[model samples]
Target: MSKKERKLSAAEQRRKEKFLEKCSTMETEGYRMENLSFSVLQINLLSVFIALPVNFLFMFSYFLFNDFSLRSVYLPYAPLLFLLIFLLLIVVHEAIHGITWGYFAPDGRKSIEYGVIWQALTPYCTCSSPLTKKQYFWGALMPTIILGFLPGIIAIITGWEPLFFVSQFMILAGAGDFLIVARLLLHRPKNAQVIYLDHPYECGLVAFLKNID
Candidate 1:
C-alpha cells in the first residue's frame, strides 16, 4: 500500500514483461506451437530398435579391423573412465547443440544449462536460442551424428577400444535425439517442449517451477 512498495511492484512487473516479450519474440521466430503426444518409452524403443543393431555391426566391424576389446581396454580405470566419458559426452552433446544453433541464431548466442528433474530423477541439458526449427533439429543431432559416431570410426582405424566408449556416448546422444524427434512428431509446443536456452538467466523457468512445487 505504501508508495515505496508500489514502486517496487511496478518495477518487478516491468522486468517480467520485458522477459516475457523476449521469450515471445524468440518463440515466434524459432518455434510454432504444436501438440506433442509421444511418450518417452516410444521414443526410447524406436531409438534402440534402430540404433542398436547398426551400432553393434559398426562396433563389430571396428573391432574386426583393429582388434580392440571394450571390456579389456576399459578395465584399469573403468569407473573413472565411465565418469569421465559420461561427463565428456554430455559436454560434447550440448556443445554440438550450442555450436549448431549458434551458427544460425540471429545473435549467434547459444546458452546451455544443466539441472535435475527430481520428478523424473534425471539430469538433462537444455539448449536455447536456435533461430529456427531447422537450426534446432540440426543442433540437437550434431553431437550424436558427428562427434559421437566419427570418433568411433577413428578409434577403429587406430585400434583404440576407447572408440567404443565414444560410440556408446553417441548412442546416449541418440537417446536425446529420439526424444526430440518424437516430441516434434507428436507436435509439442515450442514454449512447452523445446529445450534450448538463449539468455543470461536461462534457468529462471526451472527455478520458477521448483518454487511452485
Candidate 2:
C-alpha cells in the first residue's frame, strides 16, 4: 500500500481516497475502526518467519512414517511443468480468498477486485464489502488450508515428494494471510459491534467497530 498507489489507475486512486474519507467519517461519528494493515516489507518478512514452523511441522509429520534418508530433492515434473504449476497455484491462492469472501459478501463477487503490483509481482485480491469475524478469518486462511495443509497431509501419507514440497511453499506463501488473521484474533472490542473490511490499498483489513449505547 505504501507505494502501490503509483501503479493505481486514476479511478483506483479515487476509490482509495473515498475509503479513507469514509474511515475518517466513521471515527468522527464515534464508530472508529482499527487499522490492521501492514506494509509490504512487514508482510514479506512475516511470510517467511511465520510460515517456517508450519512447514517444519509438515516435514516432521512426513518423517514420522518415512525414512528421512530416502527423501529426494528431485521433483517428478520437468522445469517447465513445475514453473507452470507454481504460477498457477499463486493465482489460485488469491482466487480462493476471492471466492470465499465473495460467497459471504453482500454484493457477492462484484465486491472483489484482483490485481498485481507489477513492480513486486505481488498479486492481491481486495474485498469492498465488510464481513463477520468468522468470514474474514476463514477467507484469509482458506488458501493455506486448502493449498498447504491438506495437500501436505495427503502427501505425507502417500509419500508424494512433489506435493509435500508444494505444500511447504504454499504454506509459506500464506504467511501474510496468517498474520492478518492473527491480528484479528488478538483484537478485543468491549461492548462494540465489529466487522472487517479489507483495506483496498494495504495488506490487511480494517476492523470497523461501533460502540453500543
Candidate 3:
C-alpha cells in the first residue's frame, strides 16, 4: 500500500485499540462506554436537549415581560443588529471559557492571549490554566452551556431574533467544547494531563499546559 494508505490504516488500528481499551476500562468501573465516542448526532441531540427548552422559555418570558424588540428600535437596521449580536455572543463565549478555567484552575491565575495566522485569517484565543483534564473539560463547557440558555432566555424576553441567533452560535461553539469533553471523558489518561493544540501559527501558546503537582 502507499504511504498515505498505510498511515490511514495505522490510525484506524489505533482508534480501534483505543476504543476497546476504553470499553474495558468503563466496564470495570461500572460505566457504559456506548456514548463515549460521541457521534455528531449524539452531540446534536445533547445540545438540543440542553439548549432548546431553555431558549424557548427565556424568549417567551423576555418578550412577554419586556418591551425590547426590533419594533421598538430601528427595524430597518435589523441586519446590523444581528451582526452585532452575533459578535457579542462570540466575545461572551470566549470570555466565559477564560473566566471559568481561571477561577477553577489549580493556580487560579490563568491567562488569555489572542493570536492570528496567515496574516490574520485564522484567529483564536488561548486560555492557559493549571487544571486537570476534568477541570479543563468543565471550564470549557461552562461558557457554551451558559450562553446557550441565557441568550435564548434574553431573546424570548425581548422578542428579538438576534438573541436567538446568539444562542445558536453559542451552541455551535459548544459543539467544539463538547467534542473536547467527549475525548477527555473517553481517554481519561492515567497521568491526568493537560492538553495543547498547535496551529499553523504558533501564536505564542508555548506554555499552554503546565504540570501541576
Which candidate comes out best when scored by lDDT? 2
Per-residue lDDT of candidate 3, residues 75-142 (tens digit): 67766876777677677776776677667655554344444322323334445433455566667678
Candidate 1 residue pairs in clash (backbone atoms < 3 Å): 34-187, 35-187, 36-187, 36-188, 127-196, 127-197, 128-196, 128-197
Per-residue error at 27 for model 2, in Å?
4.2
* Model 1 spans with C-alpha error above 4 angstroms: 1-32, 37-46, 71-74, 110-114, 127-130, 182-213
Which segments of model 3 are wrong by more than 4 Å? 1-75, 117-123, 153-160, 189-213
- Tell me how far the alpha carbon of residue 68 in candidate 2 is from the true structure, in angstroms, after superposition: 4.4
Model 2 quality (TM-score): 0.89
Q: How many backbone overlaps does candidate 2 show?
A: 0
User: Which TM-score value belongs to model 3?
Assistant: 0.49
lDDT digits (tens) for residues 1-213 of candidate 2:
464444665645766987888788778877777888887668887778788988888898898986654334554655566677778999999999999999999999999988886656789998888889999999999999999999999998998877877788889889999899889898888899887889887788888899897
lDDT of 3: 0.51
- Model 1, 1-213: lDDT tens per residue? 112221223433544366567557755666432323223344445657656765787778785887654574548878787778777767667667666766776666434444443333334444444334456567666777776677777777777776666676677557646565444445334234354332222111210100111
lDDT of 2 at 18: 77
Root-mean-square deviation of every model:
10.7, 2.5, 10.4
Instruction: Choose 1 or 3, whichever is better by TM-score.
Output: 1
